[model samples]
Target: MNNLEESKTFVASLESLEPMRDFVSQTGSNAGLNKKQIYGLCIAVDEIATNIILYGYQNSGIDNGLINIHTIFEKENFTVILEDSSTPFNPLETKIPDENELGLPLEERKIGGLGILMAKESVDEFRYEYKDGKNFNIFSVRPNDD
Candidate 1:
């Protein structure tokens, strides 16, 4: 098995999304991930980070919450761990819209369920936990040899 190399960053605002994406992209690339895998990683990371920016600290009026992103590159897979100091909200618990409901018109459908759904479908493994008053989300994707 190949050893794992990791990198981390702190994201405090929506403006930091690009930097966070770049960090993950570069790390994935260095870990030998192909274009598709790297793009998937970026999308998953963006959704999680954006959720934090939009809802994590809204009630507390705290604008400086910290998002800690840890990317681990192993021989067989790449794993990313995102931890945030906002309220203990778990995206994994977010309800996904029913497939049948998707055909309804936009106004008739519910809002705000696609992020976690997309992340779950795109990544090989997705998990979450709340500990020490923090929200911890972990996502993993395997290397494709095609």
Candidate 2:
């Protein structure tokens, strides 16, 4: 099992995302994930963390917030837990349109929601929780090409 505790990363700007991605890529590799899994995990992490840093913290009058990431690898699952000290908002709560919006042209489709949808779709399991004044995004991949 791959387990990491208290792997805290502090970021006040988008500039920090590179290092975070590097860390996640390394962690995923160390956890024995395949290329597809590593790429999927990284993409999910990047999308969600970018939103948290850009909108939740930067635009919400917060100069900086701490982001702690924990990874858990079981026999058949790989999990990445992200905790952030931002305003209580759940990205998963975003409403996805019933229709297939991606098929629509950029001019015809409604704005926003594409990124969240991609992030959610990239993983086998994605959950969100807001507790103790912190926001949590749990992303996981199961056995077989998740």
Candidate 3:
């Protein structure tokens, strides 16, 4: 199998969705990720990117900003890092649904808080931080050791 390490950065706009997906697909392929692993990585990244486009620069009315994506492929693990220079907001801070609360009516429990939760469950590790007026989210996954 071939292995590669690469990184790319793009403007934080709706148009960036395709490029982001392509980057992830390429990185996942190089890291020898199977279909399921690739899809999970792409979905998690999409959720975070969508959050940035929707809320990150909304307050300042900024048209374009940087959304940096860096990927590293080692012999055993894959790591993806996304960084954006917008308002400091970490999705990890949001509350996740509880199993007991699942029995409650959907409307009565909460309005919207599922994307991040799903992303969290799908990945092996999800971490976030805010620094220098930027939000950094790091996601890591280890393929099944067969």
The C-alpha TM-scores of every prediction are 0.88, 0.88, 0.85
Which prediction has the highest lDDT against the true structure? 1
Give lDDT tens digits, candidate 1, residues 1-146: 56766657675688889999898889888887888888888888889888887788656678767888888877677898888888778888788877977788998987768887877887788899899888888888887653
Model 1 off-target regions past 4 Å?
none
Which residue pairs show collisions in model 2?
none
What's the TM for model 1? 0.88
lDDT against true structure, model 2:
0.79
**The 10-residue segment with the lowest total lDDT in model 2:** 1-10
At residue 111, give the lDDT of candidate 1. 70
TM-score of 2: 0.88
Candidate 2 residues 11-97, lDDT tens each? 746787787778778877877778888887888888888888888888888875767778777777788888898777788888865
**What's the best-to-worst order under TM-score?**
1, 2, 3
CA lDDT of every candidate: 0.82, 0.79, 0.81
Model 2, position 115, has a per-residue lDDT of: 73
Cα lDDT tens digits, model 3, 1-146, are 34556889988887888889889988887777788777778878888888888788755687767799989877677888899988788898888777866679867787466778777876788999888778898888886642
